[model samples]
Target: MSYCGHPGLMPIEQALNAILTEVQPVTKIIEVALIHCLGKVVAQDIVSFVDVPPADNSAMDGYCLAIADLEKTVDGVLPVSQRIPAGAVPEPLTSGTAARIFTGAEIPEGADVVVMQENCSEHDGKVLLPPVLALRDNIRDQGQDILKGSVVVSKGQRLRPQELGLLASVGVGSVPVYKPLKVALLSTGDELIEPGEPARPSTIFNSNRYTLRGLLQALHFEIVDLGVVADTFEATEKALIKASNADCIISSGGVSVGEEDHVKVAIEKLGRLNLWKLAIKPGKPFAFGDVKGTPFLALPGNPVAAFATFLLLCRPYLLTKQGVGNITTPTFTLPANFSRKKAGMRQEYLRANAEVVDGKMMVNTYPNQSSGVLSSTCWGNGLVVAPIGQTIEHGQEVIFMSYSDLLY
Candidate 1:
């Protein structure tokens, strides 16, 4: 896409699809206990053998009785013939009886309706159901949620806490998931220094290393830290060789056109380097290729650019490698409280404070849109997306995405 004055830039969407097309999900799969599989992608479809609830059960604390008994009983009342707590089996409801059943208690034989306790009155050992009630009013039927032989979770689904609970509900104790990707992370530049170490002359602490580490850890990737490599073709080539065994080698910086930037050249010398200027505001210089058969993704040196590109582009690529098919992020349409002076040819993400104001979701832009302003990323809830050549007018409806979202 021709991005404004920058002529040879690729659209961000096109770049994302291209990167995804070149990568494949890890082939190794392992079976783990359901609890351990939280946040892990399911490698295959999981079919449930047992139905959720297994049998008809009470959905609330109430009285269970035959529907016919409810319509014809005197004062819609019946004697409490039994009390069935959750997990307890019960005898059949007698000709004129009601069983006291708590939530999750199996429905007794011959009982098809449950009257919530609030809808019934108890006096002299008899419970009176409301005059109006229906069959199975408060009963959760067997297989209502899941039937036997049904797929509980399809392949490529990331198992969350709720997913774990759902698997347990259907008697699934273990899950098959793809092995976590082994990622070798590195930072480049002679000016980059490690944290807790004294900085000599014109050096700064390596923040991207730790930041990327935390982000990748949250995504469950096994990280191999190659530390910071000095800005030299030999050093860069050596780092790539050291990390060649990793599934993906990720390095921040040294991929631009700067004469001192040697990572791109070193990668080309050892393997391949396809560099592209992405049509994005903060993130433009992006490199994606392979080194010794292992995929490599290089982000820009700017901190904010690295953050934005990792979340928008590299994060999705990692998820795809884990066999996740639906790796898109959530988004919403909201009003923008700020205005843009000029429209840029490339799509832009403005970090901003998103809050519910006057019963509407509104985002006010963070003043600093600089690539180095990591504070902007922290202050804003997510990105306010302005499409190509689209300038924002105050109160205009703009697309908002949470830091957690993958743009669709």
Candidate 2:
């Protein structure tokens, strides 16, 4: 295949959507306790088996009394029949009778309303009641929270803490969910040394692994670390073969148009490489293709470029491969706090911090923005996306994409 010939890079969103639209979900069904399914994406919708609050219950520590039994004690107190605490089913109520009940306790038969203890006075078996006694007050209606046979959550939705509780409440012990995507990560560069290892004067400590690993973990992808490989055909080729078994392969460095960059060559020898020079800052040399049918994503050598490409490109493709729905990214618009006049036809994502200034959300760019400077990425809460060829002035609105997204 032709490696290059003025292949214009698509916009970031268009590029991402193209990749994800072609992939499908990779998951199977598993029986697990609801407690373990939190933070997992649902493969199928959960239907409620039973109504929440199976029976009407007390929602407060109060007295359960028939509305007819309510009396304005002309001179003295009214009689109390019995007491019904939580978990106890009291005998049927008689005329002009009242039962005491606690929160979460099943309401006794023939009782329709519960008056808070503080709202009524009790002396001996006889009770002095308030003039007004309302029906269904402080009573939890059956199925109020959920209904039987109803879909609690749709398929492809991520389960959260509250979702787990809801599923457990409905007695769902197991759920169908998509399995995490399995990925193999490799870093290529002869001048790269692993963190904590002694490096020569010309070498820099490896950081791509940590950056890639963190993003993978956030996406809940199962990762296989291939470690660092020197820029040689033989060394890089071996790693590529090892990663061939993965659902996808990702590597940073060596994909650029440099003589020492051997990732592209290894990709060509192993399978294919579709290198695209993106018209964007910090992330330009991005290569995406395949290795023996397994998808491959080759990121630039700079740390920031690797991170940006992963977010702007690989993440969507990976999510597509995982069969995720609602794959569009979340974008928010806020006023620009600073002015930027540079004009380009490609979208620019600058590291920025957002804060509420005078009750309005505003974003400001970080001081230093170099592809190798990963610290700016770590410090940024979001990215300020300046439109192509648009000169943004202070107080003008700009689109912002937040890094607070838990999912990659």
Candidate 3:
């Protein structure tokens, strides 16, 4: 009948899976300029129309010549028949002659090999190439990077700057991408005040607003920010209705079983909510539900708890809803320098920094693991995942996920 250290807590993985399973990917698509497509999901597979280079190009500033000619020459001396700068079309090579070529210059029609300028000697407009270099020594073959009709970008793949550049290189001017998700972001608590306001009473500036904003921005969401709502049922219900227009509504407080917490009561009147107590440290209370058909996720009030849960749980669900299939965060094992002699009932994600000790990465937790201590995350670079029912010792290898890895 009440919520305090919920007995039926969900395992971290199971909770994430359950949340992601019910969400459907948005199918809407929009065409954006090449430059603006960064951080967007590709709506369709993009097959390149032509080879990346479009032709055989030299990979060095050197001489291009037929390989057969070099084998026949006793003195290895060849006349420079043509000069081919980049963007210049070349005539067929004359017999016993080489074309002077710069890097990125198209190889002559008859040339089968390129000798870098350093390897060949030039005197009186003639180059003497040694026979030590192999055939086709420095030629970038046609279709080497991207062949015509090859898929350059696949459906549901997020476009990074390099991906956008690749699309541009393949002559794609505009890209079809999933429309940016409009997420209604809300923060609550009467003790919270937005930054830039002079504090009149006992209050803390709402850092979660900036925290969630940065997190969503990195994942390329268009946020509809609804600043801190009051701790009343009427206010909470009104805020939910206002946020219902967006595809998803996310709030950072008022889901716990406090007398003042109205998020659960408000959602019950409008829709259904599944308040999950996750078996994870720093973050435990997470609510997933819907209001007026839009998805809703209510996180804990603690800034660090909100951040951890968003990265480890909410982020995957949102990404899946956006059609991204690879929702798992990258993790690696590292030696832990700290120890926990007592086993924990739940998995603990310690805010710890890693350093190289004796050629091995060693992790050390921050001084404080308090959910409200934002400084712990500030000083640490990654999360050392100490599994449930397991005790860790010094020099033991543990699973770790860096903040840089999770955020991007």
Candidate 4:
């Protein structure tokens, strides 16, 4: 079917905005240990109770001395009054003496500067110093890294490794984070069979189930697997009813306009379904609505189409609903090494490999761009986005998005 000049078809951006406007972020919050909060969104701003490196300390293993004492000596030397190792406190510096200090040791009171041990030598209970010394040299000031009562992490920010380390440094033992979203996953097709089951005539093993599961898992959502529902009105309606318990509902297949496709009708019966004909390749028939107040997303039946649509459409919606501050996927433009003779009516996401040829980075697509061919997706590390009604030539700039950025 030609989607060109179709009045009912929605542009990709319009459809995404419509979906996002209808959904609200989950408000439930839970306290999680700092170590277990990776990939989880923060429910509240985390403020530091104490400054990092609470006290002034040494930046190196050196000697602490008063400047006045060095000036009194004939040479750059002073008597060693005490030894202060890391984690040990020292008495106040004597009027005319130096203290042997190690890295991370707290600065002794009345000491003006720390001279590196390498720049000084010890002989017969006294230490030699450089003639010219800078004040506060090799000394880390208190609150150098973080100040008390400052927000270490803001609300809606997803916790990453570096964020976790920063929180740990400020002695944050636990944090309040949004609860992981629960998603109901369903698949519909009469001719579908699960893997490990005996193969039957005219039956294809179900791959959408596994594909959707992996995508949901990568987002850290709790999946309520509804398995494969038979291609019947009763079965589809029953599945939709059960799925309404989750925060969101996602189904593959049975969304297209075909006699065997019953998901659209079933969803309408339970609540409402806004079936959209999107101007996008691989995935065209997409459904977004709510099932008994729970948001619903229905993807195309084709395996490759399901994968592409999930990344392009469903991913951002899910992230926004989970309270993520930044839901946009990162993309960059690269020169195309290959060419297409004819322009397509719908926006195309071609499975492509990007490499550095000579000194410039170029992208090349898989030989076959068929939606049913799942192997094409496995062969490429990223997708080259071709705009609607646009043709490509060699060395032309094209937008590229990586799976590494999309999967999470």
Sorting all predicted structures by lDDT, with the top scorer first, yields 4, 3, 1, 2
Candidate with better lDDT, 1 vs 3: 3
TM-score of each: 0.94, 0.92, 0.97, 0.91
lDDT of 4 by residue, 247-365 (tens): 99999998888999998888888999765579898899899988899999999999999999999999999999999998878999999989987888888999999999989999999
Candidate 1 residue 45 C-alpha distance from true site, Å: 0.8
Please list the C-alpha lDDT of all candidates, in the order they appear.
0.87, 0.80, 0.89, 0.91
Top-TM-score candidate index: 3
Model 3 agreement with the true structure over 197-300: per-residue lDDT tens digits? 89977999999999999999999999999999998999999999999999999999887888999998888889888755777887888889899889899999
> Cα lDDT for residue 140, model 3?
95
lDDT of 1 by residue, 154-254 (tens): 99998878889999998888888999899999999989888899879998888899888988988888999999998888889999999989999898998
RMSD of 4: 2.5
Residue 310 in candidate 1, Cα distance off native in Å: 0.6
Provide the lDDT at 316 for model 2. 76
Candidate 2 pairs with clashing backbones? 25-322, 25-323
* Residue lDDT tens for model 2, 34-124: 7777657788888998988888999998788788666534633557887778888778876677787899998877888888888778877
Worst 10 residues of 4 by lDDT: 1-10
The better candidate by lDDT, 2 or 3, is 3
